[model samples]
Target: MHVQNKKRFYLMVGLLIVVILLVGFSIYMIWSDISSSNAPVQTASNTTNTANADSSQGNRTDITASQAITNPTDLLVLVNKTTSLDENYQPSDLVWVDLPGVRETQLRKEAATALEDLFAAAELKNLSLYCCSGYRSYQTQEELYAENVKTYGQKEADLVSAKPGQSEHQTGLAMDVTAESVNFDLLESFGQTTEGEFIKNNAHLYGFIIRYPEDKTAITGYAYEPWHLRYVGKDVAAEIDKNNLTFEEYLKTS
Candidate 1:
C-alpha cells in the first residue's frame, strides 16, 4: 500500500509539471503572436520610406550622390547627378514611338501616348514639332556620354550629357523635342522658337514638364535643356506648372 501511494504521488506531480509546462508554452506562443501583430509591416507601396522623404524635406536642392532609387519603375522616380538607376534597369513597357522624330526610338507606353497627344495638340496650333530623342538604353547613354567627352571635353560633356545610369532617358519617360526652327537639333536655341514657346506653355497640359527650365539650372545640376520634356502625369505636371517648380522641388515639397 505504501509503495502504491508513493507511485500515485509521483504520477500526480509529473502531471502537474506537464500542465505547468503546457501553460507556459501557450503563454509564450500567445505573446509571440501579439508581438508579431504589433510589428510594422513593410511593403513596396511605401513610397515615402523608399523616397527618403526626410532628406527631401531637409535639403530640397541637395540630392545625395550615388543614391540608388528604390522605386525604379515609378513615374516619379528621381534620376539626376545625385540619384542613379541600376545599370541593368530597363523599362519593361517600352514601345516603338510611332511619331515624327529625328530618328526611330521608343518610349514607355504611357509616355508615348502622352507624347502623341502633345504632338497632336501642337499640330492643331500649326506648330510643327519633332521628337529628337526618346528612350535610351544604359549602353546607348554610355556610348553617347563617351562620345560627348571625346568631342567636347569632359567639362562640357558633364554639363550636356548624363553619366549612363543617371540619364532620365533610361526611365523611358523623357523625350527631347525639336522643330524646324532648331533644324531638328537638341539645342538651347530651341527655347526661343515659337515651337519651344508652345511646348513651354502647353506641355504640362499633356502631362509633360520642361524638365530643365532655364532658371532652375542650379537646382537641376544640368544646363537648361528646354528641349527635354519629362512625363510626370497630368496632375503632377499641372501642380509643377502652377507652382513653377522643378521636379526636384515638387517632389521635395510633396
Candidate 2:
C-alpha cells in the first residue's frame, strides 16, 4: 500500500510540472506575438504615408536618398537631383495637352486633363496661362543641356538645366508655364506677377504645384523656378501648399 501511494504521488507531481511548463510556454508565445504586432507600420516601399488628418502628430520616418525609383508608373514618383530616371523611362500614356494654341507638348493623360481644367479656370478669372514646354525626352534634354552650356557657360547652365536623366520633364509630369505678363518667358520674376500670384494660390486646387519656390534652393539643389509646375494630384498638392513644404519635405514627413 505504501509503495502504491508513493507511486501515485510521483505521478501527480509529474502531471503538475507538465501543466506549469505548458502555461509558461503559452505566456511566452503570447508576449512574442504582441511585441511583433506593436512594431512600426511604416515602410520605405510606400515612400510616405498619406497625409492623414493628424499629419502633424505622427512619428514619420524621413525619406532617405534612394536609387532610381522602382515603379516609374506611380503617379507620385520622386524624381529630382538625387533620384534619376533611367534613360529609357517613358510615360506610356502620354497625351497632347489640350489647352488652346498652347505648345505642342504632351503630358501624362491624367495630368493633361487636370491641366486643361486649370487653364480653363484661369481664363474664367481673367488670367491667361500658357504652357511653354513639357515632356522632353532624354535625347532632347541632352541637346538642350548642350545648348544651355554654350549660351550660359557650364556653371550657370547646371543650375537651370537638368542633366539628361535627372529632369522632371523626363517624367512627363511637369510643365513650364508662362503668361504674357512675363512675355511668355520662364523667369523668376513671373512669380511676382498678378497672374503668377493667381497660379501660386490656385494651382493646388488643380493638382499642380509651383515645383521650386524661392529661398528653397538649398533643399532642391536648383535655383528658384516658379514657372515649373509638377502634378502630384490634388490632395498631395493641397497638403504641400498648406504646410509650406517642398515635395521632398512632404515625402519625409507625411
The candidate that wins on TM-score is 1
Task: Write the residue-wise lDDT of candidate 1 on 128-212 in tens digits.
Answer: 8888889998999999999999999999999889999999999999999999888788889999999999999999999999999
Tell me the lDDT of candidate 2: 0.82
Give the number of the best model, judged by lDDT: 1
**For candidate 2, lDDT tens digit of each residue in 1-254?**
35668878999999999999999999999999999999988776554443342242212223232311545655566787778889988888899987753468999988889899999998999888899998999989989999999999999998898988889998898999999988888899999998889889999999998888889978887899988999888888899899998978877776
Off by over 4 Å in 2: 1-68
TM-score of each: 0.74, 0.73
Candidate 2 weakest ten by summed lDDT: 53-62
